[model samples]
Target: MKKISEKIVRLRIVVIVLVFLITIGLGYFIPRLKVNPDVMSYLPKDDAVAMQFEDVGKRFGGNQTVIVGVKSDDIFTEKTLSLIRDITDSLRVTDGIRSVVSLTNIIDIREVDSVLTVSNLIDEYEIPSEPKDLDSIRQYTMSKDLYNGFIVSADSKMTMIAAKIEQEITETIDTNLTGKALMVYYADKYPGKMYEFEQDADTMKIKINKAAVADQIRDKLRTDFPDAELYFGGLSFMVQDIGDIIMHDIMLLGPIAFLFILMALYLGFRNFRGVFLPVLTVLIAIIWTLGLMAILGYEITLVSNVTPIILLAVGSAYTIHVVNRIGMEERNGGNYKENIVAALKYIIIPVFLAAVTTMIGFLSFIYGSYLTMIRDFGIFTAIGVVFSLILSLSFAPAVISYFPPKKRTKTEDKPEKGIIAAMLMFFYRLSVFRGKWVILAWIILAGVMTFGGFKLERRVDLLD
Candidate 1:
């Protein structure tokens, strides 16, 4: 520890420069990280069944069925039946939809004399207009057992359109064209600046965004039938929903956590170095860990999206310990380099121990966990914690040395008498005055919570 501290102070310039360059390099990869909210993709890649499914995805694409439900007072009437037909036709032609099944196209079997015949439940083009014909068709349709409760509600007021998506997804081309000609036409139509395609004929496969495809399908449906009431469900829609949640989590949670951490740091240290330096270490650690994940082709998943917040909340502690120790040792008023070294020599073991214990707790999740999401959360969190510790020891001290810490004033030296202090006083009084009752309350609460924890239901779905 003494040797490492001496070296850190001796080569502080190199340490600072090297950390800055590496941080900048890692920061570049942060924007390239891709979010994959598909829960099935989290399946172990080494498993034979999963590999076979993935190969199918690469070749023929895959299925994620989304159901769109339409409601009406009378579904067999000409107007409602026509609307259903239009919806089926529109969705069938939509780019991302592999197939669509609805009341208009659902299979119907009927006995004609002695022979049985199979045909569409409702005739797409020949919807009945007359009341008698419509009622007759309705009676016949309602009598059949095949369509009940599955394609339509038992009461027949609601009908569901099931579109099995080609999960590879696609852009719905406006024209009936193929190959390079289609591309050329769009390029000419949109002109240079009007539109920009993220992928061409070749790159589309290499860079696929399933959530974008799902959203496109949703937008197309809503545009085609603006008046109709539609309810969306199933895996493809859930994927889109999860993708939205991940975006919010990444954009909002990190900043919120960092703000809270900053507030806490200010309360603790009452100095700029106390807040900024600790947070800086955490930010750098997060960037490096995320950059590593992106460069290695691991996705930002629903589970891993919380990585930034976790680092923000937990990783800053290492730097806080270092900063506090350095502040304490600096009171001796020795040489700057000597004081920094003395502080580091004593604090390194405690900081490393605290970090390693947390790392081990997270590392435990990598084993005996059934879900790959949990395993990934464990792996990256462990990595991030370690990175935080390294930066706290190396980058933090080097930067701290550059800015001489502010002298603690007599007022600042005294403990705060804010809400936290009042709360502490209350707790201290309770512990001293009502110690037995406090112990009894804790015991009862722990028992109840332990019982509740035993009854907790575990669910695997990533998106609600």
Candidate 2:
């Protein structure tokens, strides 16, 4: 409560700066970061739904697949047929594959000594070397036993390369390595579906890993064949791809927003101290939030990526409001103490309201069904918002008090009103011209809206 002065203000700023440095340093040094990605981990394991989901993922092949489409003008041509042979051969040796199906994968029909035998043919053939033999290959491909339309086109122009991935691999594969490798390469891909056996409760149906692995292989092939057309589908690959898109957007969008916020703060205050001080506060808050996550063992996910940028954008408003007030008071012949006090008095309610509203907006996410990353986001951002509110109130006051801008006097000639004043005048004129008409228009619009709402019927079964 002592008279606001330069020394008192500077002392306050020193305290804030010290706290920021300590928090940031502690954040960097703390160790612990856990990423529990399994959605089931958050749910009570004993719950029936959770158990059923786990069983489905395990017994039903875990939603992974690799699909290879072999396309050729003449799929039966010996060259393209041989290519299919080579690709199947490559897949069999690949690790973590549970099952593979193709034209060559089914039984091979052979006749010897007037008797016919149906045996696995994929193991019998070397890569067919002659283009002339494509006719015979086509005949063999069409035989009822080798491949139905499921693996080869009816006209023998295309064939499918399908594989089921092991569940254990889906559970434990290195995400960064596989995701990067697959997204970088791949041609037309389709994910396989899951079907359940009619009679067996424990038995599940379908393939896995084919799509994820195929995308990687396809991306690699792009280096040699730039025009390759690849399409990928399947529940597993779609999920992984969605996760990737989210990560990619965050990586690109967050920094750009932060830089824009810094620029806005500079333009609003027109002072180097005004820009740097709040920026430092924002940075410290960010590092502290993230550091706390790391210390508490949280992984950065799609939802948590925007927390820092949001803090920067929303938190800067406090500093901007305070400095604008200080600048206005200085121009009106007030001493530093009077200016700082007046600024604080004007902004305290607005700043507190903004912080509470922002915190509430984020808190709403805590009730969402997806809790793993989104919950973490809610908790972390809430902490940052609170810190932002406190710093905005404390740091701005201290900085203004310590610096104690040069005193103004009534005898001096006042500087001309600036662009802000001009803009306000223009807005005032616009209000005078349009105010009554705007109100009348809004009333009419509201009446229409109300009538429309009354006429509309609610449909509870719309989801069906």
Candidate 3:
């Protein structure tokens, strides 16, 4: 260890250059990092519930359905009806849309010459223009159980356009299932599927990108009905919104956290090396971890979005310890090289032990969780901790050896009566005098937090 430290200091420039090149190379993967906010995709594939859910998706249509709600003072108005018609028409033609159900597209059952006839509520070429026409349409819609509450709101002031998106079928279908059986099933289930089957027998299995389809519908609604009060609800829209929000939070929170860390470090250390070296070490760890995730083809998920922040928080501690130890040793009369070696010898074992235990704690999540995102979070964070430990042991000491802390006289060794000092003294006295009470309070707080954590429910609804 001593020989390695000597070599590191002797080849400090080379070590620094190598570290820079490696970090830069890893940083290249930053742009390539994919963000996936689909909550369903995070479910463990081997989990029975997840497999069953996927099977359900495969048998039926995709789970990605978007409900677009349009509100107005009077939805029965000619203008409102016309806008609904236009929007429904546009959505029907949207790519990857399996089906669209709205006031305009929904089926209306009627007795035509004593024969039951089923047709679209609003014809493509015809829209309700008069008050009487809209009144009749509204009456018929309200009368139907399927349309009421599902498509048209009870109050009739708001209507929902439900669009079913088709997901891409990546797996091959059962080859044993004959086309004739599929055609018969389609004929009995969906009349429209009969025509599709007739057009192409292979059309029994269809593939479509549900997310892209949802994006198209959302874009159309935003572009064409900009003035309308549109509330998009459902799995697809929720997924998209969740993705956007996660990204926004990542962008907004990351810098804020960095600034806070910077301020805290600056105030504590009162020196550039003290603040800069620890931050830089943590930054490198974060970049390396994220880049590794990208290289491994793991998408950044909502759960894993906190990786950078976690790394920043956890990784900085070792560097701080190393920096302080080296500073203390130097101030106590050791030369730069000797202090660097001595600091490493004293701190490396504890730092490594702390890092290993923390990593083991994180790794427990990987073993315990059935969710991919949680497992990925565990793996990446553990990796980041490892990187921090390595850099703190190697690069940190190497760098600090070049910029040693100035020697302090005996007078400077005495604690100053500053605000920070006063606060520390107060805390020290409190801990000494009220140690038993403080411990009891902490235990009670921990118990309350644990009980509260168990009571907290998992929220799938992003809107809530």
Pick by TM-score: 1 or 3, better one: 3
Candidate 3 residue 208 Cα shift, in angstroms, is: 5.3
Q: Looking at candidate 2, what is the lDDT of residue 40? A: 28
Cα displacement (angstroms), candidate 3, residue 461, comes to: 3.9
Which one is best on TM-score? 3
Q: Which residue pairs of candidate 1 clash? A: none
Give lDDT for model 3: 0.80
lDDT of every predicted structure (CA atoms): 0.82, 0.63, 0.80
lDDT of 2: 0.63
TM-score of 2: 0.67
lDDT score for residue 98 of model 1:
68
Query: Can you write out model 1's per-residue Cα lDDT over 90-127, one digit (the tens) per residue?
Result: 88876556678888888888889999999987788788
lDDT of 3 at 188: 60
- Regarding lDDT, does 1 or 3 come out ahead? 1
Model 1: runs farther than 4 Å from truth? Answer: 45-63, 167-210, 407-449, 461-464
Count residue pairs with overlapping backbones in model 2.
23
Q: What's the TM-score of every candidate structure?
A: 0.84, 0.67, 0.86
